[model samples]
Target: MYSVVVEANVQYEKESFTIVGLPVVPIKKSKECILSYQHTLGIDITMKKITIHLSPADASPPSQPN
Candidate 1:
C-alpha cells in the first residue's frame, strides 16, 4: 500500500483555504466540512488562511530493480 503525508499551515492573512499537492476534488471540498466541524467545536478561524499540503500527491509503484 502507498502512504501520503498531510501537512497544514495556517496564516493570519486574507481569509482563504487552499489545498495543494494535487488533492482530489473531495479533499478540496473539505473546507465546508471543516468549517462546520470548527463551528461545532467553537473554534473561530474565519479570518485565517489555511493551507493543506499532501506530500507525494502522486503515488507510484515502487521501482523494480534490474
Candidate 2:
C-alpha cells in the first residue's frame, strides 16, 4: 500500500474551503469529512476558510482490474 501526505491550511478569509491538486470526487468529499468531524466534536468552523492540498499532486490511486 502507498501512503499519501496531505497538507491543510486554515485561513481567516471569506467563507470558503478548497482541496487543491486532487480530482473532483475526492475534493467534493473532503468537505463532507471535515464537516462531519467538526460536527462530531461540536466545533464551530462556520466562519473560517479551510484549504487542503495533497502532496505529489500527480499521484493517483492504482487501478483495479475488473
Q: CA lDDT, every prediction?
A: 0.73, 0.73
Error of 1 at 16 (Å): 0.8
Listed in order, each prediction's TM-score against the native is: 0.55, 0.61
TM-score of 1: 0.55
Question: Candidate 1: minimum summed lDDT over ten consecutive residues — where?
Answer: 53-62
Instruction: Estimate, for each residue in 1-66, the C-alpha lDDT of model 1 and write its tens digit.
Output: 446666789989999888766558756556566667779999877789988766564666457999
Candidate 2 vs. true structure, TM-score: 0.61
Q: Flag clash pairs in model 2.
A: none
Candidate 2: worst-modelled 10 consecutive residues by lDDT: 54-63
